[model samples]
Structures are given as structure tokens and as C-alpha cells.
Target: MKPAEAYILNQPEPFKSMLMHLQILIEGTFPDVDLQFKWKIPFYYLNDKPFCYLNPSKKKGYVDVVFWVSAHLTKYNEYLISENRKVVKSLRYFKLEDINEEILLTVLDEAHQLKDKGFYKRS
Candidate 1:
């Protein structure tokens, strides 16, 4: 198994289950995504650019699904956790039951669509 997979599999409960579910959802939504272990976390890339990442915040007891180009997600702004950052936004999940399939899929789809548009590209 890849180190990224092992990282999720080794996480403590709630986070482990949540991360597993998210990985499945992301992969299912974007079959072409490149999953890699970067910065010691699971990073998803699209069109050879950074798309998003799955981070397990064990200390905070939640998993953060961070978007690399969150600024362009104007339609989903209400759903993001900016944390005062300039370029990224995150969706936090404290429990497995909190996963919203429709919203997550929509956000993923929109982000994927924007991958080649350069809206989220680094300067």
C-alpha cells in the first residue's frame, strides 16, 4: 500500500473511517486525480496541478478537506473554512455522519472543472 493509504488506515477511529470514506468519494468523483503523499499528507492533484488534500487533525478531533483554489468557489463560500488564509479553504468534519455527499460532490466537480482555467494557479 502507498504511504498515503497507510496514513489514513493507521489513523485512530472516527478519523480513520472518515478519511477512508473521503478517499473513496474523491476517487469516485474524479477518476483521473493523482493521489500522492506530499507534506506528509494525502494530496490530490488534477491536470498536473494541486487540487485538494485530506488532513487528519487528531488534536482537533476532525478531518480537514482543504481546497487549494478555494477562492474561486464563490458559490460554496458558505461551506468553506478559510481560517484567515488567502488562497485555501477547508471543510472540516468532526464526525463520519457529517459527510454531505451532494455538497462534497458539487464542490469537487466545480474544483475539477476549474483546474485548467488558471483561477487557482500560483503566482
Candidate 2:
């Protein structure tokens, strides 16, 4: 397990379970995507560039998938945009059981396409 994964597992209760679920869902959707710890949180990267981060705030009681490199997403994906500057451009907020599999897969597919087109920096 990655340091990030272990960290998530160490979290208590809802956070641990929710974090693990999100990680599994994302990993399942993009089995080839790379992941690491960034800013003390789980960050998912495509081709080494910033793709998205999983925010599991135990205090705030929410989890969001944040895409900082939102510049690569077209208007077609604007529906996922977040107005909060603290968050990445394309943000998807979800509760413990609210994860939409299809939407997640679509976003993963888009990220992969962007990575393949050399839209991201390589590690």
C-alpha cells in the first residue's frame, strides 16, 4: 500500500471507509493512473501532472475529487466546475454513498485522453 493509502486506512470511521471506497472506485476506473501523496492528501496524477486530489475532510464532513489541471477539460465538462478557488477547477463533490460510477468513469477516460495527448507533465 502507498503511504497515502495507509494514511487513509489509518483515519477513523467514516473517513477511513469513505476514503478507501473513493480510492478503490478511482483505481478501478483508471487502473493505470498514477497516485501519490500531495499536500498530505491523496493526489491522483496522469502522466505526472496534477490531475486530481481526493479531499476527505473529517471535520467538514465531505469528500471531493478536485482537478487542478482543469484547463484541459473542455466546456463539455463545465458541469463539473467548481467556483471555489480553494478547490480545483473541475470538482466533483460526493457523499459516502453518492459516488456515480458512470460519471467517474467518464472523467477518468477524459483524464487518460488528456494524458495521452501530452497535456500533462511526465514524472
Candidate 3:
């Protein structure tokens, strides 16, 4: 298995389940995305550019679906968490049930479009 897939499979309960579900949703939505192990997490890339990552914070009791070029995202801002960081935003979930499939899908679609337009190239 790839390191990215192994990372998800190795996570403990709740986190493990959440990551798996997220993995399915992301991969299902973007069949062309590349799943790589980066920064010790599962990072998804579209057209060789960073798209988003799955970060299961066991200590924090939540998984974050982090988007790379969040500054350009215009939709679903209410669902994203910045945590004072710049250039990135994330949809956080404490449990599988906490995931809103519609919101996640829409945010992902928006992010995907941004990537297609080379938004990641901007400062």
C-alpha cells in the first residue's frame, strides 16, 4: 500500500473511520487526483498541484480537510476554519457524523475549479 493509504489505515478508531470516509469522498469526487504522503499526512494533488490534505488530529479529536489556496475560495466560508493561519483553510470534523456531505462536496468542487485556474500560483 502507499504510505498515504497506510497512514489512514493505521489511525485508531474514530479518526481511522473518519479519514477513510473522507478518502472515499475525495477520491470519488476527483478520480484524477493524486494521493501522496506529505508532511506525514495524506495530501491530494490535482494536475500536480497541491489541492488538499486529510489531517487526522488524534490529539485534537478531529480530522481536518485542508485546502491549499483557501484565500481564493468564495463559497462555504462559514464552514472553513483558519485558526489564524494564512493561505489555508479547512473543514474540520470531530466524528464521521459531523461531516456535511453537501458542504464538503461543494467546497471541494470550488477548490477544484480554483486549482484549474492556477489559483495556487498566486501570492
Candidate 4:
């Protein structure tokens, strides 16, 4: 198994399941994308660069779907970032009930598109 998958599988509950779902979603969206385990999270890679990441927020009790370098892209539809600043510059946070199938698909597809177009970069 890949390091990313192993990391997600080893995490505690809620996080593990949530990350698993995201992993599956990302893979299904871009079958050729690469996954990297960095910064204690699973960072999805495309064209050998950081694309997005997944982490479980213990306090918030929800999974964080992070776009490592998302400061430049504009938000569309319901896809949005957690904060208004450039801090991490990517969408974060996902609740089990808030996880709509269509929404997830749209985000993943946009992520891949952003990565493919070199719109974002690893910091």
C-alpha cells in the first residue's frame, strides 16, 4: 500500500474513515494522480507537485480537505476555503453530513484541473 493510504488507515476513528472516503474520491477523480504523505498529512500530488491534502481536526471533529497552495484560485459553487486569508490557501473542513457526493466530485475535479494547469504550487 502507498504511504498515504497507510497513514490514513492508521489514524484514529472519524479521521480514518473520513480520510478513506477522500482517498477514494480523489483516486476516482484522477486515477493517475500521485499521493504523497507529507506534513503529517496526505498530500495529493500531480505532475510531481503538491496538489491537495487531508487531515482530521480533532477539536473540530471533522476532516480537513486542504488545497496546499490555493491562494490564487477563485472559489466556485459551494467550494470554498476555511478562512478569508492566504494562510494555507485551500479548501478545508468536511463534515460527514456536509459531504455531498456531487460537491465532492466537483471539488476533486477542480483540484485536478488546477493542478494540471499549474495554478497552485507547494510552499
Candidate 5:
């Protein structure tokens, strides 16, 4: 198994389940995306560019599905968390039930559209 997959599989429960669910959702939505282990986390790349990453913060008790081109995302701003970061935003989930499929999908689609436009370009 790839290190990225292994990382997800090795996470503690609640986080493990959430990461697995998110991996399915993201891979299911974009078949061409590449899952790579980067920065010691699971990062997804589209067309060799940073797409999104799955970060399970055990200490924080949450998983962050972080998008690189957050500056261009127009829809679902209410659902994306920046946490004072400038170049990226994320959808944070504490448990399995917190993964809102509809909002997640929409935000993902929005971010996917911005992939070719560079990382921090304004929409």
C-alpha cells in the first residue's frame, strides 16, 4: 500500500473513519487525481498541481480537507475555514456525521475548477 493510504489506515478511530470517508468522496469525484504522501500527510494532486490534502490532527481531534486555491473559491465560503491562513482553506470535521456530503461536494467542485488558475489567484 502507498504511504498515503497507510497513513489513513493507521489513524485512530473517528479520525480513521472520517479520513477513509473523505478519501472515498474525493477519489470518487475526481478519478484523475493523484494521491501522494507529502509533508508527512496525504496530499492529492491534479495535473501535478496541489489540489487538496487530508490532514488528520489527532491532537486537535479533527480532520481537515484542505484546498490550495482557496482565494478563488466563490461558493460555500461559509463552510470553508481559513483559520487565519492566507493561501488555503479547509473543511474541518470532528466526526463521521460532521461530513456534510452536499457542502463538501460543492466546495470540492469549486476548488477543482480553480486548479488550472494557480494557487492563490482571485476569482
Candidate 6:
């Protein structure tokens, strides 16, 4: 298995299940994305550019879905949780059932579209 897949499988209990579900959603949402293991986490890239990453924050008791260019995603502020971060923003999930699928999908889709359209390059 790839290191990224292994990382998700190694997670314990509910976190493992949550990561698996999230992996499915991400793959389904961006079928062309490339999954790579970097900085000990799963990072997804689009057309060779950083897009998003997944982390099961065991210490924080939540999973973080981090968007690389979140600062530009002000229109979706209600769905983000950066917590004083400068560039990236994230959505946190404490439980599998707590995931807002529709919002998450929308945010991910927007992020992908933004990067694809060269929004990051314009900055």
C-alpha cells in the first residue's frame, strides 16, 4: 500500500473509519487528484499544485481537512476553521456523523476549481 493509504489505515478506531470515509469522499469529488504522502500526512494535489490534505488529529480529538489556499476562499468562510492561520483554512470533524457532506463537497469543489483556474497564480 502507498504510504498515504497506510497512514490512514494505521489510525485507531473511529479515526481510522473517519479517515477512510473522508478518503472516499475526496477521491469521489476530485477523481483526477493525486494522493501523496508528505510531511507524514496525506496531501492531495491538482495539476501538480497543492490542493488539500487530511489529518486525524489524535491530540485534538478531531480530523482536519486543510485547504492550501484558504485565505482566498473568503466566500466560504462559514465552512472554514483556520483558527488564526495565515494562508490555509480547514474544516474539523470530531466524528464521522458530524461531517457536513454538502458543505465539504462544495468547499472542496470550489478549492479545486479555484486552483484550476489559476487563482493561486494571480496572487
Highest lDDT among the candidates is held by which one? Answer: 3
What CA RMSD would candidate 6 show?
2.3
lDDT of 6 by residue, 13-98 (tens): 78998889989999987898889999999999877778899977898899999999886675568869878888889989999998
Ranked by lDDT from best down, the candidates are 3, 5, 1, 6, 2, 4
Tens digit per residue, CA lDDT, model 2, 13-112: 7777777887887888787677899899999877667778888767767677777656666644755756656545644444666666667667767766
Candidate 3 has its poorest 10 consecutive residues by lDDT at: 114-123
Q: Is candidate 2 or candidate 4 better by lDDT?
A: 2
Q: Tens-digit lDDT track for model 1 on 1-123?
A: 988999989988999999999999999879988899999999998766789999899888989999988877865678889888888998889999999888888888888888568654555
lDDT of each: 0.88, 0.72, 0.91, 0.69, 0.90, 0.86
What tens digits encode model 5's per-residue C-alpha lDDT throughout 9-115? 99889998999999999999988788999999999988887889998888989999999888888888998999999899999999999999999999989888775
**What TM-score would every model get versus the actual structure?**
0.92, 0.80, 0.94, 0.78, 0.92, 0.91
In candidate 1 the C-alpha lDDT for residue 38 amounts to: 98
> Each candidate: how many clashes?
0, 0, 0, 0, 0, 0
Which residue pairs come into collision in candidate 4?
none
Q: Give candidate 4's whole-model lDDT.
A: 0.69
Candidate 4 lDDT over residue span 40-69, tens digit each: 778877777777777677887777677655
- Mind sharing the TM-score for model 2? 0.80
Off by over 4 Å in 5: 116-123
Worst 10 residues of 1 by lDDT: 114-123
On a 0 to 100 scale, what is the lDDT of residue 65 in model 1? Answer: 93
